[model samples]
Target: MPTSAAHVPEPGEGDGPEPWPQGISRRATMRISDVLRALRTEFPHVSHSKLRFLEEQGLIETVRTPAGYRQYSPADVERLRYVLVEQRDHYLPLKVIKDRLAALDTGTETEAPVPRLATADGDAGAASARRRYTVEALAAAGGVDRSLVDGLVEAGVLRPTTGGQLDAHALDVVVLAAGLAEHGIEPRHLRTLRTAADRHVSLVQQVVAPWRSQQTASARAHADTLATEIGELCARLHTVFVRQGVDDLTR
Candidate 1:
């Protein structure tokens, strides 16, 4: 009679802590979708385009299979997570983030707290969420005359809420319009931006519509996450395009 064989657990199976589950530990590399699934729990808004953008920015490294499929190791996922967390929590720009990453790679700095930029009043980011303004307050905050605010309202650039109040973002729009006005770009000329913003919003809604239609709490939450993520991504892309166009003019 042959002896009975003892049971053996496969890699990432049974007992020990599995940071990389679902047989990912056994695999040499994870596909983009696999990486997305692993990250979605913590970053519901992380998208394929975001990963590609990070790669293009030289922030993340990946291997390409013979067939051109991108392969990510566990380390790559960790590094990408670090980058995203720094951006989300610390509000650090990519240049600073990249510099920190470089320091880590060169063994110049260990994992430690970095100095953060702060406004005199406190965390402006947190404060801005609770800050609302009347039209007069908005004009004062923007350092613009009430006439500019009136012109912006007439041009449909600065729309107040139903409660007749403006949010922090309205102040930013007012200030930007005022600056543009100095350069002969009037608030009326900024109407195109409002129109473009609406179209971008419509695009985000269309992309998340199926998820939102599911009517489940999880699906609705996911849709909300996607909307926020895609909106920010669109804004970043627009900034990059504008910068590139400006660079071309200088060239």
Candidate 2:
């Protein structure tokens, strides 16, 4: 998941449009091409330029990689769902839609009513609800030592709720680390990943500062969409490079 900072935008930032859901999970990021392809079936007129135009209109915010690539999350996808549905059905312009979104950002209700979803099949789904687990239960499930679990928490990798329960994302991290442990990697060694994430997050934070400063619901979400996608690409690139290194030695 993208490490979304508190989007309390800097003093000078909100002049531009802000973003969408902050702290969105990095799972299931979509490239611009992928998003365009997915929406094509529903809106035959959907185009790359159209999505960019929507972004320019502050309709959506996207994530960017270290080298600059756009990534979209399901929340962003869902928002697109709302926008397109409203446009096609109500014939509302972007200005009208933006106002409704602003109301939502302010935690107020919007007078403009849009259908629940935009997809033709009505498949605007969401991530499953949070599944909580105790530290002991998580350790057992992940097959990692208790000490390792402690190390992960200490290293700021896994965070337990105030009630001492781990959310699904932390649990998933534990499980992955546990599998790596069997191969002689240890939690302490995992700190590099954490460090890398922190540094990249700071860099990405700089890139998205303007959007965050605005502190809009859509702006926050857009920052999240962008961060999560970059994180995904970074992870994939790391894994691919490591595999390539191994393949090279074997060759």
Clashing pairs in 1: none
RMSD in angstroms, all models? 12.6, 17.7
lDDT agreement of model 1 with the native: 0.71
Off by over 4 Å in 2: 1-129, 143-145, 161-163, 215-218
Model 1 lDDT, residue 52, Cα = 69
Score each candidate by Cα lDDT. Answer: 0.71, 0.65
Compute the lDDT of residue 130 as modeled in candidate 2: 35
Candidate 2, residue 166: CA error in Å?
2.5
Candidate 2 has its poorest 10 consecutive residues by lDDT at: 121-130
RMSD of 1: 12.6
Q: What's the true lDDT of residue 234 in model 1?
A: 82
Off by over 4 Å in 1: 1-124
Instruction: List the candidates' TM-scores in order.
Output: 0.54, 0.46
The candidate scoring highest on lDDT is 1
lDDT of 2 by residue, 1-251 (tens): 32222243432355643333323332336788877666655665556666765777788777666556777765566667667766654556568788877775554653534323234452322222235778787788677778878888887778787888887677678888888888999878888887877787787778778877874556764554455455555666778988999999999
